[model samples]
Target: MKKSLLALTVISTLLPLAACQTASNQVATAQTAEIDDKSEALKLNELTQQYFEASLARNPLMATFVGVHQYDDKFNPPLSAEFIQETRAFEQAYLDKVNQLDASELTGQDWLSYEIFKYDRQHALAGMDFNQEYMPLSQMGGAHTYFAMLGSGQSAQPFNSTQDYREFMQRARGFAEFMDSTIIFMQKGVESGVVLPRPIAEKVLPQLSSHVVEDITQSVFYAPLTKLDSLENLTSEEKSTLQQDYVAVIRDVIIPAYDRVYQYMKNDYLAGTRSTVGLSALPDGNEWYEHKIQTHTTLPLTAEEIHAFGQREVKRILEQMTKVKDQVGFQGDLQEFFVHLRTSDEFYFDSEEEVIEAYTKVKQKIDTRLPALFSVFPKADYEVRAVEPFRAASAAGASYQAPAPDGSRPGIFYINTHNLKAQPKFLLETLSIHEAAPGHHFQIAIQQEVEGLPQFRKFNNYTVFAEGWALYAESLGKEMGMFEDPYQWYGRLVDEQLRAMRLVVDTGLHAMGWSRQQAIVFMLNNSSMSETDVVAEVERYISIPGQALAYKIGERHIRELREYAEDQLGDKFDIRAFHQQVLVDGGIPMPLLTEKIQRWVASQR
Candidate 1:
């Protein structure tokens, strides 16, 4: 890996170092440089290990996700003034050390390592002024929601033994302090003009109420103890002891912690949330938003530029939809055809299992065709599961969770059956390709399986790279001969139009000062999405700014790169190598991706 970084070393060797005229001087310089490089590389690797270990210690829920059990006994305390300052200092020192590393001397995996470290440090430093903790917990999306998932055995939290039970109790006990701090953070947010939009917060109230059962034993979270019979090697006495300990922790620690937060939100924060929309309305709002765009897309595009580009794309996609409308023998224009599809009985699935089965079929077909496009594939297996009910209402239509690096858990593609209408059968094949087969499951798993990449590169993700590839995969319907049916073709266009609408709606809400209602209306006008789907999608854009930009932006980049390769390589271009070049590097900023692809092109030449 280190030698790969120095593929340019021989080129450097031929350059003049005018002062090193003597043989003895050159030998001494070369020997000293070798020792120094090794020393620095070892020091940096140690720092990486230290940081990774500390991160797990600070967030035990994260530890469980990565299959590390040592820190299962603690939860991260809510952000405090002390925490904010210390983290800033920690990142600052880490950045200083990274700046000292000689990246030019590194190659391949080492070069990748240098880039990941630099990018992570620089971005953290860039956001230090944003003060995101002021809105530490939102009813719409925040730590409170994430922690509830942890307590549910279906997630990363363990429920197998007396020791695991005891560990959870210790973690749950910290909830009161965390909730108290959450309130303080939201209170600061209200004073600082960083409140969440009212429409989104109103929707969150129902979810909050659902989670606030008066009896801890009656809560959805209690399913863990009820399902304990599935746990291996546990005797009745141990199970009884674990069950009692869990109920006590939930009743005494967890429930009260939720109640404290619920009351604070109801009494204080809810009333103070802004009736208006947009992050642009907040303090230092423009710059804060620009950072979000750059962070998500890993590109230097301004929101205004993305907004303009979205308008162009919306126009192009709508034209494509018109062609599909004619092919489907729809009697009306594109807009009318959209309305028909949304209300059409044939498009809807009778049950969630049908939707799953449809996707499974897509997977089988796509898997066979994949060999034509690429030589490499993910080693681990993957499965399709319905998104858990508790958070499904707010989750994306279909999302992918990468496998554990050690492969203890298979990758999971969560299909949101929360709204059956949203998961139309027409879109099943496309969605499967996006969230599973050649999309996230393959890309992320292949990256993790890479032998020599740094740990950070394996786990790290750039939203544009990840989401973009998924969106691009959706466009592969024609290539795979799966969009032969006009209805399925329309489904692909509908999904494509949805991404185009996101570009418009997301920029509308965050940049042009559109209300939540306006964003929903725009989506309905342009795409074949139901009102229920439109409302949920708009609220998602509200909670997560600039994230929508990545899909379309990334797809454009990947498609353009493929075109460039075809133009440059002419008959020499290999689809397999093109795919390998893209997926082999995992996720990178689009510019770095271009360079990597160009490097591959040069090698072929």
Candidate 2:
């Protein structure tokens, strides 16, 4: 699944030089022609503005996620024939207009802007045939997590206002139709063998049923109203009216809507769900799997090639892991040491608060060393928070939610505490580096804060580039004077091995026909991760094809780029400036990213 698009016959790949146009002539022409570059920049900005407005008009839930409130009460229409047709037309128009622009005429930030903008537009169009909606609402992609976000009273949805309450009621009405459509899609999955695994289906039933309660006041969605009284501007009378309306919406609409979907899954869907391992089992599985690879990597590597690479990486990381064994003075072979890390108390936190604190300490430690590695830093402040109780069971060991670009909220690094054993103290430094400080927070915040780049470039993501950079940041621990503690250093290697394992286990499960249990066994045998972690990671691979491959593959590319730059530039190379160049322009595809770095290296020379 993590393989390149060229590996499958679904889409054609373009040469890098052909896909990109030169900017020098365009820059000079813009300097003296009918308009200045700033005016040309506005065209891209206007397109972004139009795009966002169109998206909000179509999908209100997406609006809420981005801190846009006007659409808080609406859900986007179901993925249907009409939706697909309209989206295709929109993308085609944008691509046609973008191609007309002379990108070679632009330079500096403008050139970076042109490249990223064109890439995303083309990439979005590339996966048109995949039909993501065909197999949506799994344990991973369900709206269940999103509903919890709104109910938490801490996100963008306003619970204190009457208008907000009224719009939410409207949303409840909209959701009923969405659930119906989701069931239709799931039913289609049943027919196509694209259904969720039996284990995951059983795991998700409870979560869906939790929202099916008859009383709105008792629902998780009602927690916002319980906190409404604390808002200073809300008078008791206004609060009462809002609360009453919210309850009606939930009782009369939302609960029943949730109930309908829950009943369908419990009674009808579960019995028919698939027990298969990969996307290859689905209709046109080859094409869909290929699309996922291209979408994630933004490159043209084949599945067989990726599978072979994963085999090599896993072997490589395991060898590095032996050094961890020696450093810690463990008295056994690697497997036995992995067992000790699993069973031993020295590697784990006594409480969830301790997990949070470990990450906090890592942030402080990494902050002092960041200057040594690079000059660029994100302006937005970030905080570490525990993953909310309900979702933590299935959440990643740690994940990041980027702050709203408008500065309405701070970036949050959510550390999962559901299974304490999985959140070992040994992994804190690497986890913190990858998820917070120099990892996602730095990359995402710096991208958002970058000026003179097209708006799309600011938010668009490439898995190889984004996740790879985060994984590579973990290697900075030694440079930052960390990993000095042999056990902690082992944590770094273990984390690296986990990514490497993804390459092996993911391809093994999807491409090589390994069962879910087989994939878990492969990870358990290779790494020091907990059994719970092994199961979760294996399931995650199943739920999201090709996503697992991005972490290590991307990290490897960034490392290679750094090594190449150091070798090429020699005395002229500046690590801080290299970092600045990487972060200042936001995320790019690995190939294009390398080109930009080479340009910067040349500029320094």
Candidate 3:
């Protein structure tokens, strides 16, 4: 979620001493004030570095993902009471120190960095007020899911040497302890009346139970041992020893840990899960959902405003769908056309490889035309792959994982082929554009490679800018000459409709007290989505409120900014330069992004 960086929570309010004295005294006082400003700026920079370091130390998984190896063998610090209090104190102390500085004295990127740091700290503190730690794991993401990926030898954790094998064994120990701690947190959730919806809890059971295999060789935890032969540094004897140790950990520590969580979810947690779908049903849930909306959208919009906006967008896109239906010479209403698109065998693929191949071709077509629109491209390349089977059934249609800062890993676009019928052929071009080329891969990889920015700016994400930019990227399919067929053009409209629908369904479920079935029915009536896809998406909103709102909200802002720039500059407006200006600052809150872009527009005049 993004938060406002322009709202400086702390500014010095004290007035300077009297200037009516002798001119010499006044001049001396002025010099002292100037020195104080520089000294404060220096202190703020030092504090930013310190806060980043503390953040990495507290989150070892984040450290490993960013290419920092020092914490590779450790799990994240336990979410115990003591750790929470200490973290609160740490943020408060930094907030106090940063608030004393005068922003008027800072200039250029230094000032920008200060705003980001302050926004980050204050946002972190605000989130601490929520009891999110109590409901730790979810169907969406948590230690239960991510740990399996990390241990699989196919994720960020490397498995190249004897030392690497040993480090994982230590990590496996930490995993066991972490699992126990998470169960304790879930128990706390029960007492506090904070619980997952029954549907979400049911989804989590299969995810945990998937890892409880009878054979050690089949366990994802034992994946590294299977690949030991590929590591040239490990001798045959060392490989044999590591294999024995790996099996022992999976058999004794890892498998049992999963079984424990599975049993708990099935026996105790399921019965107590919430019956109502909306966050507003829970204690303080309305306030929490409001905060989520602000965080994800980085705006002060109310639920009612977002819901109404979504309704208007959905109606407009449906009208566009009608034009496409008539152009294709279909013989029925919009709903019938949707059913034809959903159920027709001609629109579906037979195999997962065929789906991957279709996206590969789309990439080829889009790459040749990118130079016409973007002057700045990422040096880090990207690859398309299937979402690993373990989580595919529950995963979104398509998602991207950013490249590593050190270039050890390229960015990945995970296309979910779990249900072929759910992935229509016509949708490939827009999905490819949004997830692979100019969407996440381009925005994220460029941010990673940006020079001279703080590490946070380079790697952190603002959901509105990131998801919004991706949604906006889908519109470029028409400009790039790929959506030539009317049906393919309809695919782009379908994509827009999904985002617009999110505004309605997410707010409807979480804010307006709409039931899960009601939201699903609303989506099915408006779009050509499969029942499977609609169900999955609605459940996602149920689990994570207000997150889906970022897409349309963000796209609307970026499109508005472009229109403003074009109107102001007229024939002088360069699309390439406008895009570069948006991406050069990396992911930031929309308010800050708006200010920076307005400045650019004024300068161009």
**lDDT (tens digit, per residue) of candidate 1 on 142-216:** 556656766777656677766777887897776566778878887888898888777766666666666677777
lDDT of 2 at 157: 65
Computed on alpha carbons, the lDDT of every model, listed in order, comes to: 0.73, 0.72, 0.79
Task: Tell me the tens digit of each residue's lDDT in model 3 across 243-332.
Answer: 888788889988999999899989998888988999888888889899889878888999999999999999999999999999989999
Q: After superposition, how far is residue 104 of candidate 1 from its true place, in Å?
A: 2.1
Per-prediction tally of clashes = 3, 6, 0
Question: In candidate 1, how many Å is residue 360 off?
Answer: 2.2
lDDT, candidate 3, equals 0.79
- Model 1 poorest 10 in a row by lDDT: 1-10
Model 1: pairs clashing at backbone N, Cα or C within 3 Å: 4-107, 5-106, 5-107
Encode model 2's per-residue lDDT on 151-253: one tens digit a residue: 5666656666667777777876776777778788888778867777777787677767877775556777777777666667777787787778777877877
Give the top-scoring candidate (lDDT).
3
Runs in model 1 lying further than 4 Å from the true structure: 1-44, 215-217, 230-235
